[model samples]
Target chain A: MLRYLVPLIVFLGVAGFLLKGLELNPREVPSPFIDKPAPSFSLPKLHEPEAQFASKDMLGQVWLLNVWASWCVACRSEHPLLVQLSRANIVPVYGLNYKDEPDDARNWLRELGDAYVSSLIDYEGKVGIDYGVYGVPETFVIDKQGIIRHKVIGPVTPSALDNCVLPLVRKLQQATAQTVVKRTEVEGCV
Target chain B: MRSLTVGIVLLCLLVFVPLAFAKEAEYMVADPEMEKTVNEISAELRCLVCQNQTIADSNAPLAVDLKNQVRDMVESGQSQSDIIDYMVERYGDFVRYRPPMNASTMLLWVGPFLLLLIGVVVLVVNLRKRTAVIKNDEDLSVEENERLQRLLAAESSPQVAKRGNSSSQKAGEEKS
Candidate 1:
């Protein structure tokens, strides 16, 4: 009986060990923001609540909304990449600090040379949750139609920005051009 | 009346109701090509902060940073394969959820079948040995029967001899 049980234990132990050692299968599912209106958020400015960033504020134009925080180590690692991305003027890059103090975020921005057009202080992270942020440093690519086009979940890299973002900008521009033509056609009909 | 005032407020609330307001717009996907690459890479990349979640799935800040790194790579005109290779080099294969199969992972592919084969062989050997012992018992019936008869004679010797006396007398008549 023990002989049989010994092999069974060995088999299970080995199988368990192998399973633990195996690579995990992680999926890249589409975020809820795709093809939907951006979630509205009213966050006070990092320094001044008088000039806040709201979801409705990004309508009628394209933009890149990045969620970040000083407490997030990856945000710091990706900071240099954001600096590089600022050079690309495809769309304005804005910051939404997820549950961070204004002073720390300001210091981080100051050190990093302020890549965002303006930073919104989401001290409570409620706004970040509404955006379906699983964590910090998520970036959404928004088109002029106020629809979310793509989401990047991690830090920015120079190559990633050029290869993934520029093409989308081009696509959005093409779409905008078609709309301009349709508008002219509608005028002619009138 | 208070009822009238409440009705007005209710009407106003009904007209401009606030339901579950989800801020879905926080995610702005890039162009199709770039978004595809970025999302793909994020799925493969590990979020160091939440070590378990991939950059594609985790809502953690680290996940976002890793995603931005992938985006940066895409924006810099690097190929998907190259970016992944670079990440692997920097962070080791642990960074990728589905790492490329190689010598290091051979046990993962081949271990289960080997274990099953060993288990089946052990079972077959045990069954064969048990059946062989049963067949050997069938060939020893005569010796076992004699031993059982001797044991009974020793226990009831006097009574059994009187019964055998009549048989002996019959044997003498047969001889004459």
Candidate 2:
């Protein structure tokens, strides 16, 4: 009887793992960049070609770095949500226009309504590669110290924005504000 | 005239086709040693977009980019292991076509062999049980053996013996 139960237990164990795996999105691979410093880049602004944008400029601010392309159909799906989030002014969203023509990216923003603080042009996609972008429409949440907090692969859904993105943004913002206050207090004492 | 024109167009295409292919071949390393290292490393790395294929074999855009990255790294004096380590560091062990043995991958490495061992044990146990049943059926007590022999002796009387001998003779004649 014990011997008979062994196979059933093994089968249930495998089934449990399979059920858990089924709930997981295979494309939602965990990024190694989390808790690590965000990869730095200096690329031209998409709207203003003569101007440039760099990751270092966004230091001491909790921000979203969204990697998008005009050619990516999935970006269209998430565009409206990003626009809504931008309108809320919860967090500053920066766009990395990945591997797209400058004119086409400008045209897309013109049609879709711009949601980013400043869209950076990664024309050669070298920045995207550094960010470990395997697919387009990936988003990263970076903290005040330039450390990456979270990475969301694929389109950002409404639920993801509320549950994952918004909550983390609020937490990081509070943490940074406290740190600023503490720093000022120490400086006054000095 | 139309057929001749078609033939000329086909001839032109044939002549230009090799040139297009030659241009694509330019991405390969100039040094044969470096090319071999790139090939080996590419074969080990999985194509993220085309999950089942190695980067070397996949034509997906991401795969092509990764191949180019590998080629560039190989050309820049990076060791073969360093390139693989960089990819694994970024993409995790999932990027490796052949995952290394570690705590996370222990089940993947051992699950099949464990299953085989269990199957062999079950087979041996089942065969032993079946043989024991057969042996039990064949086993006869001393009293049972004596009863069987007595019954046979009673059945073979003088008249039966005479008839049996005649039947045996007939069977012998048939065999001959």
Candidate 3:
């Protein structure tokens, strides 16, 4: 009985892992930047080329860094949702206009409605590379301390926003920058 | 005949034209040494857009960009591991064609040998059990041996004639 049972258990364990693997999306490579500080960059604003927008400006605020381009067809799908989210005033959505002509980007916003608090021009896609953005329409939920908490690889649909991003953002918003203090407190106790 | 000639010309153009263009686009770097370093690094890194391909083999825009990134890093005199680490820092270990042996991948590295070990154990146990069963069948106890000797003596006596007669009668009945 033990002999038969052991083989059956091992077979089931392998089968279980394979079944779980079948359900997983292999296309979504997990980002290394999660829980790490957001890569910092200052770039010219799409609307005003003379003016600059920096990532450090978003410190002390829970925000969304959306990597997008006019050329990206998927970005159009998530545009309305982003616009709505921006209007809702729940979280500020900033755009990193990845590898787009300034004119085309501005025109796209004019047609689709601007969803960003400020759209920074990543003309060479340097900032996008820094953010570890492979696919356009990637979204990152960043906390007040400028750490990237979560990343959405593809288009941000309504369900994803409601289920994952919004909840995390709300939680991050509620929490204070007490991590440093908490660490010291634990040290004191120890 | 003229149409056939045109068709042959078209085929030649289709095949050779791309070959010419491909030769031009094949080597992105001029320096052979720099190209070798870039190629080595690219071979280790995965193309994010085309998940199956290494950046060296992929033609996707992102793959090209990554190759150029590798080239730039090579030009700047960074070591191969340093460039790979930079990519890993951005893309995680998934960007690597060869996964590093860490706590997560320790099982992946050791799994085959572990399976072989289990198989050997099972085979040994099964062989031993079979040998034990055969030995038990071959070995007879003292009381059993005595009983066998008594049966042989009884068969050799006049009881054999009686048994033989009974079997012959049964055979005759079957024949009838």
Candidate 2 residue pairs in clash (backbone atoms < 3 Å) = none
Per residue, candidate 1 scores C-alpha lDDT tens digits across A1-190 of: 9989998998999899789867543433335456566777777787676886777877767788989988888899888777666776657888898878889999988887788888898776656645666556788877777777777777766665666665665556567623522221222111
The local lDDT score (0 to 100) that residue B77 gets in candidate 1 is 94
Instruction: Give the fraction of true interface contacts kept by model 3.
Output: 0.89
lDDT of 2 by residue, B1-176 (tens): 99999999999999998987878845645688777788899999999888889999898888888888888888788888899888877787889999899999999999999999988998999999999999996687997777556555645666688666765666558559
- Residue B101 CA displacement from its true place in model 1, Å: 32
User: lDDT: which is higher, 1 or 2?
Assistant: 2
Alpha carbon lDDT of residue A73, candidate 2?
100
TM-score of 1: 0.44
**True contact recovery of candidate 2:** 0.46
Candidate 3 lDDT over residue span B82-120, tens digit each: 999899999999899988999999999999999999889
Q: Largest DockQ belongs to which candidate?
A: 3
Q: What is the lDDT of residue A85 in candidate 1?
A: 69
Q: DockQ, per-model, please?
A: 0.02, 0.45, 0.67
Segments in model 3 whose C-alpha atoms lie over 4 Å from true places? A1-8, A180-190, B1-15, B140-176
What shift in Å separates residue B17 of candidate 2 from its native position after superposition? 7.5
TM per prediction: 0.44, 0.79, 0.79
Q: lDDT tens string, model 3, A119-140?
A: 9999877778777789998999
For model 1 the local lDDT of residue B114 reads: 89
- Residue-pair clashes per prediction, in order, are 56, 0, 0
Tens digit of lDDT per residue, candidate 2, span A1-190? 9889988999999999999999888865677777778878898888788998888988988999999999999999999999999999999999999989989999999999999988999887777877888999999988898888778889999988877778777777888434532221222111
